[model samples]
Target: MVLEGVYKVRSIDEVVELLEKYRENAKIIAGGTDIVIALRNEKITPKVLIDISSIDELKSIKDEGEFIKIGAGVTFTKIVESSLFQKNLWGLYKACRLVGSPQIRNKGTIGGNIANGSSAADSIPPLICLGSTITLASKNGKRKVLLEEYYKDKANYGMKEDELLVSIDFKKPTENRVLSFAKLGLRKALAISRISIATFLELDKKGQVTTIRVASGSLGKYPMRELEVEEFLCGKKLNERTIDEAIKVVQQSMDERLKGRSTLPYKRVAVESMLRESIGDGIKFLDGVRA
Candidate 1:
C-alpha cells in the first residue's frame, strides 16, 4: 500500500484539522490492525494518512460521575489492565482479553475496532448492551450518538468525513446490575468470532429480572441489540424455563434474518448456547457480588 502523505498527529484537534483539509482523501490510522490489511488488499486508497496513535488526550479512562468515559485511543491491553473493568465491567474485560493474540491486543485500539465496524467486532456487542454512546468531533463541534445506531449500513458507519471519534461513554452499572459475554470461534486462541452474545441484566431483590439488554455480533449485517430477547426477559425470573424461551426467540429471529446464508444452520444452533451461557454468566456474576 502507498500513501501520498502520513501525519503523526499528537492531539484530537490536529486530527480534525487534517480531516477537514483532506476530507474523503484522508484516512485515520490508530493501531493499523484493520487499516493495514485494507490497504494491502487495495480495499482503501487514501492520499493522506492521519495517525492518531500518539494523541495523549484520547488515551485516558476516567469516571465522570454517572458515566465512565474511555478515550478512543485506549488499547485493548490498557483496558484489560484496568482494575475498573476487571472489577466491574467483566464482560468488556473478557471481550478485550479475547480480541486477538497478546501482540494484537497491545496494538489494537478500541476506537479502531469500533471504527472498523466489522460485524465480528469484539467490543461493540458488550458496549451496546451497556447502552454506550460515542462522541464524534469536528471543527464545528462534537456530537454524540448511541453506538447501536452508529452503523447506518453494513459497510458504512455514520461518522462524518471531518469527524474523529474521541471517546465512548456508558452509564456505570450499579450493584444490582451484571454484564456478561460469550463467543463461539473456530479455535480457542486468536480466532475470529463466529458468533457472540453480550447480556446486561438488572435483578430485583426477589431475583426477578428488572431490566435486560441483549446484543449480538456476527449474527447479522452488523452487531445489533436482540430486542425481542430483551423484551421477553424483562420482568421475568432467570430460570431454566425463561432461558430456554429466550433462546427460542433468538433462534427464530436469527432464522428470519439469515435464512438463505450458508452459515445459517450452524449459527442458528450455535447462538443458543452463546446466549444461554452469557445469561448464565450474568446471573452468576450477580450471585457472586451478593455473596
Candidate 2:
C-alpha cells in the first residue's frame, strides 16, 4: 500500500523555499500522475510533497521574440486548446493530445512529463524532434538545457535536487517546414506507447529537404534524435525509395543500440511505419497540401 505524505505549497516562491530547505527530503508534485502511480507501486516514498500546481507564474503560454514559451505547469489539455499552439505548433499540440485520457491530460503537466524523464513520455519525443529546450529554476537561479540532453540516467532525469522545470521553449519552425508526432500503443487512448516517432523537416523552394530531425521513443534507453537518418534524408527527395532507405538507416542504428531487447522486432516495424507516414505527411505539408 502507498503512504501519502503531507502536501504543501501553493506558490512558486513557497515551492522554491521548500526545495531549498528540504532538498534531500522533499519532492515536487505537479500533476501527481507519475508520482501517484509510483507511490501506489511503492517505487517512491517522500516525507513531504511540494505541490506547485497553484504557481501562477508557472502557468502560462507566451510568445517570445523567436520562440513560444510554454510554462511548465501548463496542462496538456491547455496546450491542445491553446490557439497559439494550434496555429504555430501543430506537432506539440498533437503530442499533447496523444498523452492519455482527458482527465489525465487535464492533470498532467509538461514539467512533470519532462521531469519524470521516461523514454515513453509522449511529449518528450516530439519536443526533441522540434529541437526544444527546457528551463529549470531554483532559489539560486536558473539554467536551460536541450531536451535531448536532459536525460541523465536510465531511471531519472538530470535535474538537480533543488531545481524545478519552469518552462519549455519552442523555436519557430522554418518556412515550408513540416512537423508531425506519431505513436504506437497497444490500445487507443490512455495506453503507454510501445513506440513513438516525431518528425520535423524543412524543405526549400525546389522541394529538397533542407533540414530534418527525427526522434524516436521506446526504441532505446532514452528518447533520442536519429541524426544519422536526418543526415541521410537531408537534400534527398521525399520519394518512396529515399524514405525506405532513411527508415532502414534508422532501423539499423536502433538495432545496433538495442541489441538484446525483446521488443526489437515490433519497435523496428513501428518505427519504419511511423517514419514513412511522417515523411509523407511532412512532404505534403511542405507542398502546401493537406496531410
Candidate 3:
C-alpha cells in the first residue's frame, strides 16, 4: 500500500486533528487486523493512516459506578482479561474471547470490530444486547449515539468522515441478571461466526421474564437486536413450551427479513440450538438460584 504519511497519535486530540485535516483521505488504524488486509488488497486506499494503538485515552476499561466504560482502542484480549466482565457481563467476555484466533484477539479492538461493519462481527451482538452506546469525537465536537442506532442508521448516526470513535459504555445490569451468548461456526477453534446470538435477560422471583434484550449477528444487513423474538419472550416464563414457541417467532421474523436469501434455510435450523444456548442458560442460572 502507498501512504503519504503514518502517524502514531498519543492523545485523542491528535487523532481527531489528523482526521479533521485528512477527512475522507485519512484512515484510522488500531489493531490493524482487518484494515491491514484491506490495505494489502487495495480495497481501501487512504493517503494517511492515523495509528491510535498508543493512545492511553483510548486503551482503558473502567467501572464508572453506574456504568462500565471501555476505550475504543482496547483489544479483545484486554476485554477477555478484564475481571469486570467475568460475571453478569460474561457474554461480552465470551464473544470477545471467541473472535478469530489468539493472535487476532490480542490485536483486534472492540471499536474496530464495529467499525469494520461486518454483519458477522462477533463482538457486536453482545454489545448490542448490553444496550451499549458509542462516543464519536471530531473537530466539530463529541457526540454519543446508541450503538444499535449507529449501526442501523449509519448514514445519519454514523461518525462523520472527520470523526473518530472514542469509547463504548453501557449501564450495569442487576447482579443476578444474565447476559448469555452462543454462536455457530464452521469449527470451534478459529472459525468466523456463521450465526450468533446474545441474550440479556432478568427473571422475576416467580421465574417470569421481566426484561430481555436479544441480538443476533449475520441475521440481517447488520448485527441487530431481535425485537420480534424479544417481544415474544417477555412476560413469558422460560420453559420448553415457551422456548419452542419463541424459536418459531424468530423463524417468522427471519422469513420476512431474509425471504429470498440463500442462507435462510441453514439459519432456520441452526438457530434452534443457538437460541437454546443463549436464552436457556439464563433459565438454568435462575433455576439454580431458586434451588
Candidate 4:
C-alpha cells in the first residue's frame, strides 16, 4: 500500500493536530508491526501516516501513587525488561515475553496491539484481568475507557477518528494478589495465540479466594472476563476440588457461547487445562510470596 504522506510527530499536540486535519484519512503508526502488515495486505489504506514512535512523552512507564501508567508508545520488549512489571505484574510480563519473536516484541507497541483490536491479541486478556483503562486524546479533549469496553463492535474499536490512544493505566496489585497467564498456540516460538487465559486471584489468611478475575482471549468477539467462573471461585479454597469446579464453570460458559462453532470441542477441552495452569500458577505464586 502507498501513503500520500508520512509525518513523524514530535508531541501529542502535533499528533492531535494532524489527526484533526486528516480525520479518517490518517492512521497513527507506532512500531508499525501491525499497521505495516495491514497496509501491505490492503486492509488499511490511509492517505496520511502519523508516526509517534519518537515522541518521548509516550514511551515511559511511570509508577503513580495508586496505579501504574504505561505510555502508549512503549514496546513489548520494554514491558518485558521493566523491573516493575517483572517484580509485580508477572501475568503481563509473561504475556509480553510470549508476544511474537524478539524482533517483533522489540518493535510492537502495546497501544498498537490494543488499537488493532484482534481478539487473539496476546496482551489484552491480561490487561482485562488487571482492570486496565486506556486514555484516548484528540484536539477536542481526552477520554478514558475501560479496556474491556473499548471494543464496541466485532470489527471496530470505539476510538474516534480524531482520537489517539495515549496511555494504559491500571491499579497496582497488592501483596495478597497474584496474576497468572496461560496460552495455547500452534508452536512454542513466534506462535499466534489460539486460546489463552489470564487470571487475577487474591487469597485471604485462611487461604480462601477473596477476589478473582478470569479473562480469556481468542474465545470470543473480544477478550472478556468469565464472571461465572469468577463467582464460583470466590470464598473457595484454591485446592484441586476448587480448580476442577472452576474449570467446569468456564467450560460450561464456553459451551453456551460457542455451541455450534467448529472449534468448540477443541476449545472447551483446551480451556480447562489453560485455566487449571493459570489458577495453579497463581496459587503457587501466592504460596511462594507467603513463604
Candidate 5:
C-alpha cells in the first residue's frame, strides 16, 4: 500500500544522521529513477526518505591523484558532456551517451547505476573493465571495494540497508590505452541491452599489448569481467587470429546462467562480433588510424 510517509531530510549530514538513527528504515534517494519504481511496485517501503539529491558534495566529479572520482549524484548527461572525461575515458563516455533518453540521462547517476546493480545497466560493464572501485559510506565510516569483486553469489551481494553509495573511482587508464564499449539492444535508444561489452587494452612502449580487460553485461546474473579472456589476450598481438582466440576464450568463460537466457542464440553470435569490432577499434587506436 502506498501510505503517505513524511518525506524527510535535505542534506548529506542529515541523511547520514537519519540513517544512523533509523538504519534499515531509512532509504537514500538520489534521482529515485529506479527506487521510485521499486517503491511503486511495493518492492521496498522505507519509513524515511532521505533526499541526498540536494547534497553538493555528492554531485561533483574530480581528479584524485591516480583516479577520477565521480560523486554519486553526477548524472549521465554530465558524463556525456564533459570534454575531459570524453578525451581520457572514451569507453565510459560512450557508455554514458547510450544511457536512456535525454530526460533519464539528466536524472540518472553513476552512483545510482552502481547501487541498483541491475544486470542490464549500461555503465557497469565499462566501470568493471576500467577496474573501478566503489566507495560505500555511512555514519559509521566508509569502505571501498573493487568494482569487479563487488558482485557475488549468483546475484546476491551483501550491502547494508543504511549504507549510501557515495562515489565511484575509476583509475585513469594508462597513456595510450585503447578502450571500447558496445551494446546491442532492442532499439537504438531507451532500450535495455540484449548484450553489452566493454574492452580495455594497454600496450607497452615496445608496442606489445600488456594489459587487457573485458567485461560483459546483460549476459550474466551480474555484470562481470571476462578475466579468463583477458588473461588469454595478455601477450597476444592485435591480429585477426588473436581476436578470434580471445572470443573463444570469452565463450568458454561464460557462465551457464548466461547460456540459458532468452537471448542466448542472438547473444552467442552477437557477442563474438562485438568483441571482434571492439578489438579492431582498439587496434586502430593503437596504430594511429583513429583517435
Candidate 6:
C-alpha cells in the first residue's frame, strides 16, 4: 500500500495537525472498511495514515438540543444498536441495519460510507432525506458541507485533502414527522442495494402533507433528494390517487435523468414499490400512533 506511518490520533487537534503537516499526502482512516479495500486494490496510495479510531470524541452519538450529532468514526452497528434512532428516525436505523452484512456493519462507519463516494451507499439516501450536514476539520478551522451537495461533485466538492470529516448532524424529526426506508437488493443476505428509497414526512392535522423529503440510492450518480416527487406530494393528502400521481412524476424524472439508459425501464418500474413502501409505511406509522 506504500504507507510510511500510521499515526493513531487521540484528538481532533492532533489529527488536524497531522493533516496540516502531511496535507494531500495523508489519508484519514477510521473503521478501515472502505479505505483498506482501496489500499489493497492500489486505488489510493497515501504516504501517511492518520487513524482516528482512538479519538473518543469521534465515536459518540450526541443528542444536542434539537439536533442529532453522530461522530464520523461511529460504526453502522453502533447506529443499529442505538435507542436514539427509534421512531421518527427509524429510517436511518433501517438503512444502517441493511448495510453490507453484520461483519461489515461492525466495521463500516457512516463517515467512511460518505467518503467512499459510492453511488449506491445506503446510508446516504436517508441522510439526504434528513437534510444532514457533515463537518470537516482542518488546522485552520471547520467547514460544514450539506450532505446533498457533497455528492454533486464529489471529486472536488467533497472533503478536501487537508480536512478530516468529524461528524454529521441534522435536525431531529419531531414526533409528527416519520421517516421510513425501503430497499431492493439482489438477495436478503450480503446484498448490495440495487434501488433504495427514503421518505421523511410530516402531515398536518388535516391529513395533508406539510413537509416531505424523498431520496433515492443507485437511482442516480449519487444518493440525492427526489425534489420533483417531494414537490408533487407537498400539500397533497396521502392516498392512493396522490401516490399514483407521485410515482408517475418519479418515473418522468428518471426518464429525464437517465435519458435512454438500458437501466431506465427497470429503474422506472422498480422505483414504484420503493416509493410505496417508504411513503406508505411512514403514513401508516403516523396513523397507528393516532389510533
For residues 36-143, write the lDDT of model 6, one tens digit per residue: 888999988999999998899989999998999999999999999999998889999999999889999998899888888787888999999999999999888998
Give lDDT per model, in order.
Answer: 0.90, 0.81, 0.91, 0.90, 0.79, 0.91
Model 5 per-residue lDDT tens digits across residues 1-291: 334354445556676677788777767778888899988888998876777777788888898778789998899998888875664378788888988789999998888888888998889998988888888777888888887888854234446776788888877876688678888878988977767898888776665678888888877888988878888889867777888888877776664556676667777788898788667767667667323
Compose the digit string of candidate 4's lDDT tens values, residues 132-240.
Answer: 9999999999988989878645235488889999999999999779789999987988888899999998888789998999999988877888999999989988888
Q: Per-residue alpha-carbon lDDT of model 1 for 31-55, expressed as tens digits?
A: 9999999999999999999999989
State TM-scores per candidate.
Answer: 0.96, 0.93, 0.97, 0.96, 0.91, 0.95
lDDT of 2 by residue, 92-206 (tens): 7888888889999999999898888788888888788878888888898878888888874523547888888899997877556667877788889788777888888887776
Clashes of each: 0, 0, 0, 0, 0, 0
- Candidate 6 runs further than 4 Å off: 153-157
Off by over 4 Å in 2: 1-7, 152-157, 289-291
Worst 10 residues of 4 by lDDT: 148-157
Error of 1 at 53 (Å): 0.6
TM-score of 5: 0.91
Order of models, best lDDT first? 6, 3, 1, 4, 2, 5
Which residue segments of model 3 deviate by more than 4 Å? none
On a 0 to 1 TM-score scale, where does candidate 4 land against the true structure?
Answer: 0.96
lDDT of 6 at 266: 89
Clashes of 1: 0
Alpha carbon lDDT at 102, candidate 4? 99
Clashing pairs in 5: none
Question: How many steric clashes does model 2 contain?
Answer: 0
